[model samples]
Target: MLVTAFAANKTPPPSPTTTVNHPETRQIHLKPINRRRILTSLAATITPFFAPRLEVNYEESNLVTATFLPSADARGLFQMPPPRLSNRYFLVRAGESEYESMGIINTNPVAKTSMDNGLSKIGKIQTVKAALKLKEMGACDNNCWIWPSITQRAYQAAEIIAAINVVNRSNVVPEYSFLDARGLGAYEGRPLQSVSEIYASDVVSQNVKPPPISDGTPNESVADVFVRVTQLMSILETQYSEDTVIIVSPDSDNLTILQAGLVGLDLRRHSELYFEPGEVRYFDPSSIPKYKQPASALYKCLNPPSCT
Candidate 1:
């Protein structure tokens, strides 16, 4: 009865009289089941999935319990852990570009390199004034670096700054992409007045990306640019200490966004901290008000899905 019940679960066997498929179908050999080994195999497979999870939870509890600050209870109160900046940062907005004088937006790399679209004559004068201002402030009295966007206008400004500040050409490092102007996506080459639409979207959320271009130019969100800027900050903090860094940008957006992050302002409102062409500001982290730190928590990402 037991054998009949066990065999009932498998495919029906051919009758003893049936010889048609006997030569065609090959018999599969069956090994006797080892209950202990099977159980051991399952334990090996399943234990790992839960064991590490349990171990991670235990470790995280010990690591984060005393250190983690919940945002809910800390409302309206200033929190510590300010941005770790070991260098003096002088944020400079490069002088007006030829495109700006023409009332156009030209963020395309090829066009930016062209003299027709690069810095205007007026821009060169503005850059010289900004550079002279830096020299007057004694910004490069100690070790200093002149960092600029790869855009021709910014590079021009950086050269002027290096000359005025007596910094070496090697120290005038041109940032290839991160410090470049915020690409306006499909709005590229459009009238400068069209930028209001981009800022309108930015006022709503930092994650809003501009419409993508057909030429494979990426439309970046404020968050995307923020990530790049954050990476740049990390690199600068790690590589240099107690040095002066002059960060030059082709447009106001990059400098404003960087200032917003450094001062703990909501990134969505970065446009509020605008930088005019040829504007120069010395970034001092210690000067940030306590109110800015506490207000940052209002937009804090505490829970999942609601974070972005």
Candidate 2:
């Protein structure tokens, strides 16, 4: 019953959860700017789905980020439908931005350095959590492919698949990449000199535009990211059709693709998906007619479930 996707002859109920929201805080002046970056695009895009004559600001709406609204991602599916849920690709956003202090550039120097201090500690902890979640969600330990961005932050991904196959040790092999740079130039890895050069909001106070993220070329937009991700899924279906490929990538890169994907699908709602520290998501090919598939919400460490 816990894993079922549909209700009995009626619309499924809205999400019910026990997590509590902390009191809203404006303690940091920089906070609102982060919300504005993505929400602005969402609001403007949603207007087209409403009555043809509707208008919206998208900049300041609380409802723009309704996570538990089961139909939240539905509206996005109407315009550009999500890709078929291929069994081979399991997209994952690596644990929290633990490297916020390291300034985002994964140049040769940084790449050679291991994640240090608290980020290293938290990164491993989150990887283990995600490992446990994926197994419980029906993933088999053998023949898994761990794909991660060719950045230092991706060290967490190696640890993740390792945790997934603790007993066998050789169950999965990891491959790091910059989006298949040689052939797939459709989207390129960000080449930032410093973290400040990465996102518009990252250096908003500087009053400068974000430089081209790829060899000084124009940075890819959210829509571009979505297209590239879908393309990768298709390629993997051909390459690893019999195995699973779990992706580990950055937040903005992965989330932007997801947020844009929800809009492309166009179901019925306009909301930002919530991805927290140690978050893991699963999409099963078996769940065809995916617009109706429920979001994975199985939580652990509550009351223990007895072993069979």
**Candidate number achieving the greatest lDDT relative to the actual structure:** 1
lDDT score of residue 256 within candidate 1: 71
lDDT of 1 at 111: 61
How do the residues 228-283 of candidate 2 rate in per-residue lDDT, one tens digit apiece? Answer: 56565545554665677667664434543443343342111111343454567664
- Work out the TM-score per prediction: 0.68, 0.45
Please state every model's RMSD to the true fold in angstroms.
14.4, 26.2
Cα lDDT of candidate 2 equals 0.44
Best by TM-score: 1
- What are the Cα lDDT values of the candidates? 0.74, 0.44
Model 2 has a clash total of: 18
**Cα deviation of 211, candidate 2, in Å:** 5.3
lDDT of 1 by residue, 1-308 (tens): 01111232356444322212223344332334557878897898766444322223665465642233344343322121233667889999999898899988777665656776567888888889999999888899886998898888999999999998889999988898888678778988789999889988987678899998886456888888776677677767767889999999998888777777776667777787788888898987656553232354444543311124
Q: Give the distance in Å from residue 82's predicted Cα in candidate 1 to where it truly belongs.
A: 4.7
The number of clashing residue pairs in model 1 is 0
